[model samples]
Target: MTARWWQKGVIYQIYPRSFQDMDGDGIGDLKGIARRLDYLAELGIDAIWISPIYPSPMADFGYDVADYRGIDPRFGTLADFDALLAAAHARGMKLLLDFVPNHSSDQHPWFIESRASRTNPKRDWYIWRDAAPGGGPPNNWISDFGGSAWQWDEATGQYYYHAFLKEQPDLNWRNPDLRAAMMDVLRFWLDRGVDGFRIDVLWHMVKAADFPDNPPNPDYRPSMGEMHSLLQLHSTDQPEIHDIAAEMRRLADCYGDRVLIGEIYLPLDRLMHYYGREQAGVHLPFNFQLIEAPWNARGLAQMIAAYEAALPPGGWPNWVLGNHDRPRIAARLGEAQARVATMLLLTLRGTPTLYYGDELGIGHVEIAADRVQDPRELREPGLGLGRDPVRTPMPWDESPNAGFTTGTPWLPLNPDWPMRNVARQAGEPGSPLMLHRRLLALRRTHAALSIGDIRLIDTEGDMLAYERHADGERLLVALNLGHDPQRFVPPRWARGACLLLSTIDDPVAGDGEALMFRPDEGMILAPQDNS
Candidate 1:
């Protein structure tokens, strides 16, 4: 039996605005992406998941979608997207678009009509309720981006709920009409031959039927985002979400070979249900443990073990090191360990999602205050919550704009672009790009590294070890994830094995007696004569 396309595929994420700029308008457009299809193809990713490109108000950087079925003019028209999709398909790569169903931009026609009057025919399309007895917000829910979740709409004489920015009004999935409309939006794109969708904020689409204030979180800390201030009991992740996910699954199945990727951040127990009540949920409930777990060996080991055990039967796992919203692995773990992260992600049991620019080791950049475009930062100043540092443009070469654009980029490039650009790293030995390419190539020829079963190998402090086996082929992945050097005594199962790939290209990777590992070194090894 053949595995599904998503089962063994590696997904690459592109923040389109920062990917490339062809029109020289200081923004990345669909045409610019099409121009770089060859580059991504060379990266060896099986699928490309581009962030939101739909017509949006830019309140949350494309999350506040103004029109569900139209492309944002800034990112070019539907024709450009069609061409890009075709280009990607021609290269044997799949394309996944970011789909936002939880909310719509305040400017959306539905929202406009819904807020025009309390008696508007579309008033039920959004979550609106009468203000409290004191004319305050209807509930105590808070926005994920910050502040109260309810926005007072004087024109409609009510408070409408917004889980993010006020410009992003939450849609009422309880309303059959709105659900049908969103489904049609998905159909419109599916009809255009796009491969799939990464459903944004998938768990937040449905809210408690009864309006109630969320209880204050006992564990809330000032360091955490403001949304954590409440327990979110009545705000999100409601039971009805299962049915909605099933609906989405049914729709995607209508187009054979299509996938549904959900963006969910809940704990493993809660997150697993997205796979479906009867194994009919999303094709992949994105596992973000890598992003949220501690960088230490113990933290990651425990998390990985728990996640592996929690997965539903026959559910495929995925690993994500970084994304547009999170800090880059290099930025968090330094360039050295970022290599280990790459090896770990690629050699893991399931799909691996790579963030653009990570393969070149370009991470967080210092953005000047004036050039900051993230509204979450502007709204909650001094919270150290801005995501602009990680969403900078991809550095292609040492051109004036780092070869991303002829004009000034929307945000500053990584400070080290002059040396860390992809053009230079593509040729340099032991470069981050080369390491990624080698691992990707290995994955192509080694089924044991992809679609394999994983077993935890015992190791001491600051060390993580695991085995991936399939069809009698076995490979061991060992890593020292700390600043202190460590030693690895190969298990009996790993006897007579040699290093397949190392973080620093160390020639002798567990080939002989107990080896002394350099700080932050990661290695993949195959048993002698195993293949």
Candidate 2:
């Protein structure tokens, strides 16, 4: 099958608020992103998935969007966004905007009008229902942020459903007018030359028609968050969601070459359905298994195998190591093992997404209780589920504030920023940044690594090995996920393979035809004949 640009390219995610601050306002903005376009281009990423920049009340940061088409003043004006788009395209890099379709900020005009009165013209635009007996919420559904999903509105004498914060009300997808209006929102951006959209909370767009109470999760634990207390049977991932996804896909298809990426967090079986019965659904249903899976070779191998096996025919696969919502790879796994994870992510038989600052091995920054900025953390304090640590500002240099801004940043920089900044690591040999650059360079030069077929060679102990082949070229990727040296014996076809890259700088040695991998090291080997 012929590959689309998105299918063969690597995607880098940039949290706009933390990427850079060109005007030194302390918060990164659109102009800031434009200023760093050259840096991203040099990083070898084909596309950048920027988080939401829409007008908002900052309730849930930018995710709680107040205006779908307007740019938030904090991020910059629409003119700034246009310039950034042009700059990215000029560098041959595609830009993807985050599209939040599930809900809108309570301050949104539509939501304000909808809640004005029961007889208002926009009353049906959002999900509203009469209170249950005893004047409580309509159902037992819980908000992902916390508490009941239904929020009581005194003026309307009814409760409006919100899957997240009460300040963000869920839209009624069942309303034909609402669906058309949302589609127009998609068109508004597509017409502006956005290459694609990373649809936010897509599966939550359409919930159960009956609003049934979700079943209790028998395996729930307090540490997993309150949302895990229920199976989410009625709140999300309803079967009808696929039809809605296809509708979004169709609209995106209207504007040729644009991709639709759904943010789904379902199991492999359910997640694959987002591809549609005939692969006509979202182009890429974001795969987040790696983020939740254990950081071990055997566990990752099994998860990868399951994901690979679950994909529909003609469906493309994608991999993600980290994102704005989760802890960084270096934080989840130690710094040494993060290198192995990077090798595994880039060498897999799918498109890979790199989170900003991950290339420099940036781990979670310590967020003191008084300094925490995430609403989730503020809402559910002491749960250790806040995402602010992973959202710290990017360290560009060793200068004050790591050169991210001239003013105080929204969040504190990692203390190691001086040594870990991009400027310091860019030219440093064996640095995490250099390793990422080399991996991306290798992927660009080798079709086998970019669009190849994968075969799991070994998944025993703390070692996981795989072979990637395409167009008569084969590359073996071996990762040692342990603290002790491990031996990897190549298959007969790779007997004379030459080491192309290694996490460690020293030459790889062999013991009786088997290559010895230093602890926590990963290497890529190409057959001598092909090399």
Candidate 3:
């Protein structure tokens, strides 16, 4: 199998609205990102994946796209996006746009026309059906936000399906015309030099034709949200979805070297199938295990092994630690563990994605009652589902608004931004930012860290250890996931390997022979030619 750029390179995700703000409308824009391309390039990332910047109503922020081919005014114009794309390419980095094909905003022209009348030409563009005989939702499908997924339309006397917020209605991908239009949307960006796309809700593109009610989830818990009350057996991961992905994959192949990545949240067995019947679907299905996995040695080791064992032949793997929707790593696993997580993420066998500001060890910021902005929290307050805390603006310097904007930011800055800002952390030799820079730099120079063969090493205590070797270069990554001091003994063959890097600034971190792991420490040992 050929090694693609996406397979070896690191991807950095930038939530456009939180990265930087040039116009100072208290929102981030395309030109703002273009201006900071140098900073990202310096961070040693090979690509940048900007979240949706398409025309939207700000209902789901930029996810509820009103126009697929145009940029939102708040995020600047098409010309600005082109400039940003050029800027990224000039710096030898790839740029990936977010594609939300599963749904469109209620305000979108297609949805507008579809809702105008039942007999309209565009009526079939979205999912619509007659109400149930009892005059409620057609079935028991629940919205991802809350309540019923079906919304009654007074004029049409029918109900429309929305997997998420009512304002973001789900599209009917089974429609031939609708699929064609979406394919055109893909071409429009490909023609403009987009490297690829990180498609949202890829598995939700198709639904069971019969529209059978999903069975109740036997393990549903209140904390898991009301949407989990019923298993999504009928609504998601339908078999036909893979066929649509194959079509998209074929189209992408026309633009050589272009890759397609899907945003799928499923179990290891189900998630691996997104690679398609013969690995012809999306280039990468986005392994989010790292984002949701528990921070424990045995569990994490098992997850890595299970995922590795489940990959389809010729299918590459990718890992994600944090994103716009999930809580920051430092907040969930503590600052010390976040460092270890970073090492784990970059040293893994395949591509890794880094969320912006994570390099500076930015954790979740508290959202006050008055400062709450996430729609999920607003609809179902106190569910702890609000993502605003993790989506705060990036802290650049110690100046006002953390140098994010001249005007008041859309979200509050972290109170400790003065100490955690990029400018401050960048200069700290032992800061998390430096750790990221060092790790990324190491990945570039060491093939073992990127595309090599991996062997899981069993350990005695709360330690996760693995060896990655290819050619004559070999490396061992050992991590202490617990608070107690744990020791790791490398295989007898690694007699000459010494410590290459440590998570903390320690002058005496151990070698491969008899490694002593301090609480919350992770280290890499190198070059055992004996293997």
Candidate 4:
């Protein structure tokens, strides 16, 4: 297999608005990230995936892009972004930008022009449809933020479609002109030295052309989220999206070694399609089973097996345990169980994505409704509590505002920062952050973990065991997920293995048969040399 930098390297995700606030404007900006490039380098990440920072109305935070080519005034200027790119490269880390092409803020020039008159030159740039016979939205589609997905325009006497918020209208991918315009936007950034892109809501790019009414999901409950009430069967994950992805992949390849990671939230079977039949689509289709599935060895193993089986031959795998959109992994898995999840994520046969603040074992920071700034929260009065908890500013120091900013941060810092801050954790030898650094170093040094074939090893309950082999070498990993000690049945291949890394201190030698594990412990063993 040919070596690809992305396949063997770790990527860190930075939600720019929450990473660091240099101006003390209560929000993080490009300069803050540039200042911290060394810190990320020290963490041993090869790339950093930054969320959207384009000009926006801030309707969905930065996801609602008003101008794809311009930097938001709130995020500084294009020069600041260029400086950030230089700093990241200097530290040996590539920058992967977020591409929010599925939709644009209603304030965008294209949307404005399209909505100006019914027969504007750019009328087809965005999805526009006539109202129902009763003068309501043409379909029963719902916005992800809340309410109807369509808003009637007084000037056109028609409703423009928005999959997210009224301020963010869905782009018309079916329009070749719009697609070409988006491609030009891609070239503009690729020319500016962005290493790659994390395409947002990739599956939502192409909607069913016929606009067929989505069937109602039998399992759907309004409590699941207003958006989930309507089945998205035909409206999302359209087959035609593969053609667009192929085009994107070709564009990225033109830049040589740049990658396109897709944010696809479909089942494993469908998610694999993002890789395309000819391996001409997304280089990495974000694997979300770990985030959505129940926390159990059996369930996780099943998901791993399913994903492995579905991957296109020669297509690489990627894993995401947590992100700004989901609760922290540590909080979802019990405080003690978080380490087990981390072990699995790092040791799995894929490019693992580390979410900022996750290495510090930070849990979701509870933000009161009055303090919540997410548009989803504002639009819905307590529908699923919104994503503000996961989007809180990074806790750096125990000082006021967790040292994230000199002034108050845009969002409140987690109240538990005194104990959870990086300052406190960095001081501890066995801190979660420290553990991450060590694990990353191990992956960097050991080809077995960094680039190896994964094989499951059968063992007993509350524990998951696997082996990674590359060349002629084998590395064994055993994770005990419970608080109690468990016995280890020596597999034929690992009977005489020597312990290399362990969460808990051990005497190096195990007398076969059984091994005692203390709480959330994990062990990596290398074959013993009997020379």
* Error at 317, model 1, angstroms: 0.8
| Clash number for each model | 1, 0, 0, 0
Give the winner by TM-score: 1 or 4.
1
Q: Scored by Cα lDDT, where does model 4 land?
A: 0.86
Report the C-alpha lDDT of model 4 over 70-99, residue by residue, as the tens digit.
Answer: 899888999999999998888888999999
Candidate 3 per-residue C-alpha lDDT over 272-366 given as tens digits, one digit per residue, 9 for 90 to 100: 89998853999999899998888899999999999999999888989999999989999888899999999999999888999998898888799
TM-score between candidate 3 and the true structure = 0.98
Q: Which pairs, if any, clash in model 4?
A: none
- Per-model C-alpha lDDT, please? 0.89, 0.90, 0.90, 0.86
Root-mean-square deviation per candidate = 1.3, 1.1, 1.3, 1.6
**Residue 525, candidate 3: alpha-carbon lDDT:** 83
Poorest lDDT segment (10 consecutive residues) of candidate 3:
507-516
Please give the TM-score that candidate 4 achieves against the real structure: 0.97
Work out candidate 1's RMSD over C-alphas.
1.3
Tell me model 2's lDDT, rounded to 2 decimals. Answer: 0.90
* Model 1 error, position 221 (Å): 1.7
